[model samples]
Target: MTMTFIIVYVVIALILVGLVNLFMSKRKRKMKTQRTEQTLSENDTSHQSYQSKFNIRDTDETSEANDANAISEENGKLNISNNSDETEALTSDQNAVTQHEESHTQEEEINEKLKQKHSAFMFGKGTSQGKVLIAMIFGMFIAILNQTLLNVALPKINTDFNISANTGQWLMTGFMLVNGILIPISAFLFNKYSYRKLFLVAMTLFTLGSLVCGISGSFTIMMVGRVLQAIGAGILMPLGTNVFMTIFPPEKRGAAMGTLGIAMILAPAIGPTLSGYIVENYHWNIMFYGMFIIGLISLAIAYIWFRVYQVTTNPKADIPGIIFSTIGFGSLLYGFSEAGNNSWTAPSVVITLLLGVVFIVAFVIRELTMRVPMLNLEVLKYSGFTLTTIINMIVTMSLFGGMILLPLYLQNLRGFTPLQSGLLLLPGALIMGFMGPIAGRLLDTIGIKPLALIGTGIMTYATWELTKLNMNTTYSHLMVIYIIRSFGMSFIMMPIMTAGMNSLPQRLISHGNALSNTLRQLAGSIGTALLVTVMSTQTTQYVSTYSQDLDKTNPFIKDRLQEMAQAMGGEQMATQKILEFVQKLASINGVNSAFLVATALSALAFILSLFLRGKEHYISKE
Candidate 1:
């Protein structure tokens, strides 16, 4: 189908979905109002019962007192000594007091029971809780899937738009930048809005963004769509975790959380392969269309099954803290991204990097002093969390570096089709997804230290192998190495994260998770930018060296150029071919050099893994 037709179809679908959701919401609101009225009526009836009982008791006490007084007056008027009557009146008064006390106690007990019942009814254990969770997971899966679905298509996008690689990298970097900025705000959003409301808004934004992307004819519009999608995605990510934490009690949380982890892992795992196949065989717009449809379905399900499980309180946002965080993260991302296009020594790069550092430091200070910080930097105080975060950041950088560079190497250097390139990584992605839960199980059975050691060892070996990639490298060879690397990654991410979180007090666990998530996003962005910059710089250097050598009085080079000129029918065509060959050769060598750097990063992460303490140490803190 044509892009226009597909975009139109998606827009229609979104409109229909929006209309249905609006109708459903209105109906739901009406139902809620009716339920509230019924509940108020029940409470009023209960209150009236208590009032009636008090009123009757008071009347009885008044009648008894009047009778006692009348009897005393009669006794006095008759001048009759009646000790029995006096004793009876005293006993009657005691009985009345006792009865009144008993009635009041009964009223209080009944009221307490009513309150317990009302609470249980209002926050009743949902029969469809499992369905609700499934709906949420589905939504979260699609949102996260969109995050990486375009990674493999970036090169194609650059070619189609005639944009430079540096400009194209923003497709990834910009998405991460938006995510990094929005994730911290999620705590405030969750506190201020109902989960159901936040979810609807998030899904709506995502669906709308997908439609915009599907229809976008320009890079700027595409980026705008991506940013909007990121906003929704950022909200949904933490929203999923928050929902799970609220719905499941502590004992059942492990299994629920494991399922959540599966969604997170599996989405990105399959994204490239899916994007590859689509981009290869179909229009890239189809990817957005598919996501839009999935998002629409998820929204419908959410309308039917999603419930607010936690009470929300109005929480004030940390405005200064938010501004500082944005400046810090945004500037850092901008600096790194620009470094790919401009030299590292460029004034823009230097100034932005400095500003990023300064602002981040100031943000740290502000968070430390604030009564309610946006990010809760205090979680870093826990030794295990700090260690795990450092390791996680390094691993994240390495992972993102590979994710971006591999596509370039496969497509640009190796001349693989997008589909072929995506297929090359499919096995590894599947293996990673399969290994995630197994690693979690292992974390439960064994611990983090052993897993970290083995996983990091495997990762280091695979990354070292990657550094040796060249034109002659076979696809099967790459696949095997990637599978091993992915398996290693599965072992490293969850075990270390679980171990670190385990070390934290219950109160700090959420903050630790947030911190971990933010750092991962930042690491990915910085890593992609840094690696791309290195590759670009190295490529330029290699091209310069080749050009200078070509200008020298080398007989072999002269003979090759002359033969090429005769074969191509003229010096003009020959010169063009030589230039093309030089560019290609430089690009391959540059990518190889970039991989070498990635290898060094992997080595550093491996060394850090060695310091990971046993689970016993982290668990002891809890």
Candidate 2:
């Protein structure tokens, strides 16, 4: 037992060490990527600035060319260069020059107007690529930390609350359900409020929620706190992506958004192990307490470094649109969240699902018809954007959906501690964490398709390996599987983001990004719900089948039962103990089979990834 404990400790430590290394490496990579992107943006700016001054010269050139053309038309009769001001201004002479120059000057003026509009849209006075990247990356960390920290703390919450296995899921499920509803509303808020203000508000809500959750005396209070965190998290998720597009140049947005994938992997990697330590040695509330402090620090940093005074605003609060988006997304997620606990055939489940569908459909019709739409549907006209968004949803479902199963299987079935289970996730989490940014950087050089293929291929293998896990599987075997899956996730995530953003106009970047992030969150929620439902249903079947051989009439079983009862203090107590033990054993096996179901979902994700198109690295046409 000591040896096993030591091994577990070592595994946990290694995973943390690996994650720290990966984090450090990504920071370094980010700096390097930032420098390169900055240099390119600077060069573009310099070229555009130079071209602006150069245009003054062109206006004069056009005037001179028109004068020459007039002179030729008159057989050198105009001689405007030598003429007196009064002579040159004569009606007959001026009219001749005006006739030749009229259409040409009008064309030049139109061209200049178009150029100014393009410049205003792409490089607004206050917006800078560097500033946007910084803000978005920070948002990424906040969003990720919010979700991942809770994952580690859930088990301790279950023990403390004395909740059922299914009830325990609400801690996670509720967060996602609330978060999903918040995402669509967030897009409108981003337009309505300053990004800096919205971000600070969200962080504040999250911090406050953490405090509430940490100090709560009852499950009800804890649930409310979780809801607070969800609200903040929902806003930040899409906002993070929006910031990237708004701030970064069209060409460099891929590398900027890639940082988010790194955050996604890193948050989960650190959250579980760190929270595990907190729960084991201290109180489970320590997770939220820690989150509160982190949130405060992030909030301060964001406010100080990222200014709100300069935030662009042309917001008209679309009350109708906001209502539709919230109700639509909220109902849909609620249905998924409730599905794991309630009978699928129950009226509540059916009614909630139907309501979800109705709201979503209404949201679509309303957004399309609105004169000033909150979500610009025009961006979806791009095939690359549409396809990548689908890919994002599928991958998110696979990754987040499968994540719900593995930890549960390790802890409930294999009897591993939270720390040990989290340690197991570390390898994959770290690898994938690094994979996303690296793939993002690679998007700078090669292309997205090959990287995506590589990612999907690894995921396929990892999913296949997952299908093979059983009750007696060793730690080493699981580690290998996680590593492959993490690497695949890293490869696939960035490419999908880059591909989608690459196809959009700079002005629509924020709206497009918001859509992508929203889908990713929805995918996670749906995936988690789907997997939980599968596991619960499948486990019931497995338990019934496994219990079949314990017939009461068998002579050997009957003799063994009598002997067991004799060994115990009394027959009555012995029978009770035997039944409890049997139920526990069945529960463990049931969880193991649930993981097998998760493996199948991942396999499905791999198949979907195959259909997605490759990288769309930006090359300026002009």
Candidate 3:
């Protein structure tokens, strides 16, 4: 149904545009014919005047021999009159030609404006590259809105479903899974379609998904809606990065992308807080509905300000590449999803992990051998690009890993509500949002490598600090650490993207962008899953070990257990209290360990950045 809808709309749009072109062409031909007739009339008048002057000169020769001096003066006066008439006619012809030329020039300028307007949909429109910057800003805002809008609604969803923290996180995990699976596919689709049409389609789908989510009565239905929205996000997220690079000349890509980074970092960070406020004051459904409205507005802009009817050469789909990507990514995420519920030793978890590994291996082999590949593996031949991509992956892993772990820690262990947990992220998000653009402007003057190194170093240090948090840590302390950590990310994110893209050839920007976005998605998936799985495993182990020491015979243990029971006051409540305490304490310890691992990941990113060679700015077009 979606495919058919897209095709029909594109055809109708093109037909209308074809008619407009036809009208303009016919008008130009008519004007050209009229100008030709006027030029012919001017030539005939000039020829007649030349013949009269010759006739008068021959007659004067005969008359001057007969009448002498008196007739000579009369002949001179007649010659002056003829010359004056010829000069007046010549001036009149010149004026007519000049007026015709001016009209033609005006028409050509009008045609150029029409051409620019037509190109705006597919390639975007502007004289000074300002439109490229504007499109990027819009893309950035949309990306941020997609994720952040869900934050406030997560708690309401959890409470309504009566689910565990792990189960409730599916709101986020489901979106990630769908988005992760489709990123490569988006790359293929983007190349095969017009940018304006694709963007509008994405926005429309997103809006429809939001409406579906708002009306859903069941968890399954809501998840289905989320899946729909994820498809749009999957495409747009990558599109935003690549489109800017394609629209702008190489020299300004960093500055442009840097401006985009503000929205990128700001969205996820702010999503939770805004979601919290909306859900708390109103209802969860309202949040989704609001997103729907925003999507519609974007769609309207696309229709009015852009043209989406350009044709494309449909490349053969890479079947092997698609299979490998789907299976590899699908199985990997499945393993993580299962780990949230099932033990690592469980048959289901084991099988999923094994399949994921096998598919990933197959994907690598297929990409290496294909002639016209979906993912161009040849770019990896450049050492700087390869290392930079790896670093990007590592950085995203740690960033997303913490995004998952931190919220869970606050809600499950510290007994904070969803609103409070989201609030906790606000300060960090605010700091990073403001800093992103500043970093971009700085990169324009200073080198990308230095800025990237400095940012990663701070991120590494921040990760180490996060590893030190425990159950008893104060909110104020966590807030300070999060702020510092976010500030560091603001520096690293834009510079790396700008530098790597700048290094690529102009023709390779699209492919390079596709690869970069794909890697970031992979990193987020791997990082989130690893963090969750490790926390779950370690928490269960800690609970079991501690249970052995909490026997009734141990005096200190007995006293502590009795005190907890008395604080609850009822037998049923006492048992529940003990279990909750055990779970909460275990989680705190597990999260600290995860943060330590994140620290290690950030360090690896730092090492990879060192291999990124010298800074490469986008090459300017002549």
lDDT of 2 by residue, 1-622 (tens): 2223223322432343234335434444554466457656766775676566557656765776687667666755765354564465475456756754764576567567645443332433464556545665665675677677766667678888887656667667667666665566555566545566667777777789889998998787887788778777877777777766555565565677677777766886777777788877998887788778878877766766665332244456565665666656766666666675566776666776787788778888988998877888887888777876786787777777677778877887778988898888887877877667667777766766677667777786777677666667899888888887888878777777777777777656667777777777767767777777777776677657756877768898778778888898677776677666666566655555655655565566566656655444333222
How do the predictions measure up, each by TM-score? 0.75, 0.75, 0.73
Q: For residues 283-377, write the lDDT of model 3, one tens digit per residue.
A: 78887887888777777665665443333334566766776776667666666656655566777668767877898789878878877667776
The CA lDDT at 540 in model 1 is 96
User: For residues 1-622, could you state the per-residue lDDT of candidate 1 as single tens digits?
Assistant: 1223223422433343345346545555665666568768988999898889789889988987897789778888999887887788789889988988998889889888876554331223453668767888899999999987987788788888888876777677667666766676566566555678778888988998898888988898887788678778877888787676556544344355556676787787688888988877888899998989999999998887786544334446576776777767767766776676567898877887898899889988998998887677778888888998888888888888888888888887888877788788878877866776677667766767888888888888888888787678999999999999988888886667666666666556556767777777778767877788878889999999999988626888878878988998987898889898899889988887887787777788889878887666666344
List the candidate 2 regions with Cα displacement exceeding 4 Å.
1-136, 152-174, 212-227, 307-313, 552-604, 608-610, 614-622
Model 3 residue-pair collision total: 4
The C-alpha stretches of model 1 lying farther than 4 A from their native spots are: 1-133, 151-174, 215-224, 245-258, 544-552, 559-566, 570-579, 619-622
Ranking by lDDT: 1, 3, 2
Lowest lDDT 10-mer window, candidate 3?
1-10
**Runs with alpha carbons beyond 4 Å of true place in candidate 3:** 1-128, 151-155, 158-174, 219-224, 306-312, 548-583, 617-622
lDDT of 3 at 328: 69
Give the best candidate by lDDT: 1
C-alpha positional error of residue 115 in candidate 2 after TM-score superposition, expressed in Å: 8.5
Using lDDT as the measure, name the better of candidate 1 and candidate 3: 1
